[model samples]
Target: MAESTTVDIESQQAELDTYHDEPGDRPVLRARFEHNGSPRYMLYTIKRLGLDHEHGFHLDVQLVSDSLEGGVETVEAKLQEGDADLIDIDYISTARERADGAPIVAIHPYGRTVGGLVTPEDSPIEDLTDLRGRRIGVVRRLDKNWILVRAACRERHGFDPDEEATPVEAGSKVELTRMLRDGEVEGVLQFWPIVPEITETGPYREVLPMAELVQDLSETDRKLPISTFLTSEQYLSENPDAVRGFKGAYRDAVDRLTSDDELWEDIGERLMYEDDPEIVRAVRDGWREMVVADWDAETIDGMDRLFDHLLEVAGADALGVDHVPDDMFRLEV
Candidate 1:
């Protein structure tokens, strides 16, 4: 028999550390969100929110940055495919294609939606009807704000958008926006990265705020879900402790950023690392003014009303889902 060398001992230790036997010691929870500034900042800040998550587990928030390559639906598809524990997206109650028959539900709401219709400065478009027959930009189902535009066009102009409008799909946000800027598309019906908050406001002008448009079209003043955290029924059942820990820390982090402006800016910079500081500042200012830390009663009521509007847009035979998924939200840890 021979004694092992120092390098050999260290190698063995590294191997032993690779996996943990205890659930609390080294569990990793994978949460997914799109590759944009808001979710980006939230994930980055949540990572540094300090202390341990439930059962001593740590969260590994996945940034689905393939918006340009794979398209926006890729992130939601990942969740539907059972590849993640949680997802970051808007809580739009649409019986969307990929989500059919899936028990995917919204767990928490974090921020307001930033989607808007941006058009060229010199464009002649003035109303939703003007977009008819012209090529319009869309990110497919991921652009949750499209329901507003569709409802407006259908009710106000007496035209069916799905049939009347020429929708140009570019898969990714970058491409969708490029088409709009190059005049390849006449209008961009999108939000988040394409919104004026996180992007430059010089070359484009906002034709409609998604919230206002949805309100006008639906003929109701109830608020709609802008952003939310989602998870599956199985994940919640299997990882109750971890889920609670993550949610608790998340709500705490939400409250913290609202109170601490410096922390918000610092985290905002990291969240928008790819953005210009000026743009980030403008976004941060707006974010500070509206970032939601909790889902209250009025908020929940607004969401319920949103479902009603979605039903109106989708119709009985279409995609309107009445509830935000059966008992999906947990108000406390």
Candidate 2:
């Protein structure tokens, strides 16, 4: 594939408008990511520190919005349309898309970035069992978190939330948080960064971190990668060096995120939606462990087992793919 054309980060999205600016001779990897998400913390670090250039590539960061008309497209749409070179998505969603012949591949793991079941502080719902016959808010019924909840409920409590309780699809993450805050739902499964914002600022608390269930179901002591860095097969085959450069930069970014306290403070001030010191600390502490810098054969084995478990519990309809494609994961680059 040809070197991806760089978009002026300042002209693309106003929420987070900055880039490395110095491309030099490195190939450009256009990354379409969600605004104010956890991935931005690393992307920002890469741009701020010029990690991409150091690793022999230029990181051209593009922010995607929930809607397409926001000047930039959604991550999946941008990637599939070939408007962007790469993006990060949950592996399960990547499986579903690839099964539908989207031709995307998971290049590396992004660690266990799944959110937990959060409930209001005063609610009587203590555990997954208590969620029975209650309204639960989610981004969508088919979201990985909701499916995990369903599978865990069935496997652990012998009850399926989908069948026993009403799942209100709030349509988006913002609305999901609002649903829980307004008492529209007894509990909500919101993503990280946002979860800390909700739990730390008000009368909400995490009932369970989904990572525990991921460990229980995968039956691995390791925190396997749920979300992964993805790219098109064309991009990977044509620009192998660019992909390798990205992986190296990503590893460095993860290292910095792990040991850098001052960087978190900078992120809190500039990148975070809620910049409260407590929320910033919560996000930093919770996020550092969720990022997997690298993966190997053993890690792939655990991911395979996790996929089988999801297939067994969530079923094809909920998973959106009957089976994971053979070429879905391409870590070689």
Candidate 3:
């Protein structure tokens, strides 16, 4: 893994050339990600696909310890100006809205699921309605889960998250888990893969899952978009072969993740800090529980709904989904 930094276009092209070992060899693909967050998951998935070796790709995973706000800003700055073959990020909608001219390669889809710190014996908060007047800890106001939770609360629960409950912002997952463990918040609306680790640490309860709640409310299939792989339009135009190769490798990773339980167990142990085997098992189980699909009509519509909610929360102009180019999501096969 190499460090990600600003590079001139020529130098970046030379870096891509390294993926090509011999004359007329396949170009090496370089993917960049902000080290600690969802993008890291994407990087690992690519690795599992064996893309680095298969296509002579280089994975450049950089750890930037900024909170959500700063992280997004850093991502935007890099995509708009930095020199990397590709950049992976969560919240594709936000990235696309900010970097309008970027070429995005949607390697795979990440469905949204929720978990909270609650005891098993506690009354199951099966839906957002049950969360009324309860304090909730969130990673950030703009987090996709927060957006979905707010929508669910408004439409299904008939309660406004802004008006009904107190919201505390935690700097990171560790801080958020601490808030839950110390009884600072009644529940925490977090993505599925993360909840298991938080619960294993203390005597917390399991509430309703975000994915189930969304299905109940919409009466149609939907999953919140968590992340995607993206690059500048220029990069994609210059290195179409590399993009295709990377996409193939990523899809391979998704297949492995979808089918192999042992692989996920290994991933859980490597990614999560909690040593409890139960937690690791729970995380693996949770990953299998959610949907992972390509960007289809239903998924896009779901994203539209999410972006609409985001606009309401941020009081900004609605994101134009029509602007998302047809080639945004790549089917590696």
Total backbone collisions for each predicted model: 2, 0, 6
Which number leads on TM-score? 2
lDDT of 1: 0.61
Error of 2 at 117 (Å): 0.9
Per-residue lDDT over 1-333 for candidate 2, one digit per residue giving the tens place of the 0 to 100 score: 111212322333443446547677888899888764589888888888888888999888877564333222278888998999989888888888888888899998887989988998989999888987899998887678998988888788888788899999876676688788889999999987788889888999999999888899998898899999999999998999999999998999898899999999988887776789999999999898788989988988888888899889878877777787887888687
Ranking by TM-score: 2, 1, 3
Please name the candidate that would achieve the greatest lDDT relative to the true structure. 2
lDDT of 3 at 79: 58
Candidate 3 minimal-lDDT segment of 10 residues: 1-10
Model 1 C-alpha lDDT per residue in residues 1-333, reported as the tens digit of each score:
012223432432233233323345655677766654365555555566542353256776555543533343666677777788777666653234224576776667766665677787777888777877878888764356666677667667788676777778766665676687677988887665446532474577777767676456444554445667777777777877777777777767766666676775565444443346566566666666546666776777676666567667655333344445545555554
Off by over 4 Å in 2: 1-16, 67-73
RMSD of each: 8.9, 5.0, 7.0
Runs with alpha carbons beyond 4 Å of true place in candidate 3: 1-42, 45-49, 63-66, 69-92, 99-108, 113-127, 222-226, 291-302, 305-333
RMSD of 3: 7.0
Which of 1 and 2 is ahead in lDDT?
Answer: 2
Query: How far off is residue 44 in model 1, in Å?
Result: 0.9
The CA lDDT of each predicted structure is: 0.61, 0.82, 0.55
Worst 10 residues of 2 by lDDT: 1-10
Off by over 4 Å in 1: 1-27, 51-56, 66-72, 93-99, 197-202, 215-223, 296-298, 314-325, 330-333
Q: What is the TM-score of each candidate against the true structure?
A: 0.78, 0.92, 0.71
lDDT by residue (61-149, candidate 3, tens digit) is 44443244444434545555554566645543544554555454555455553444343336455556666677888776555556566
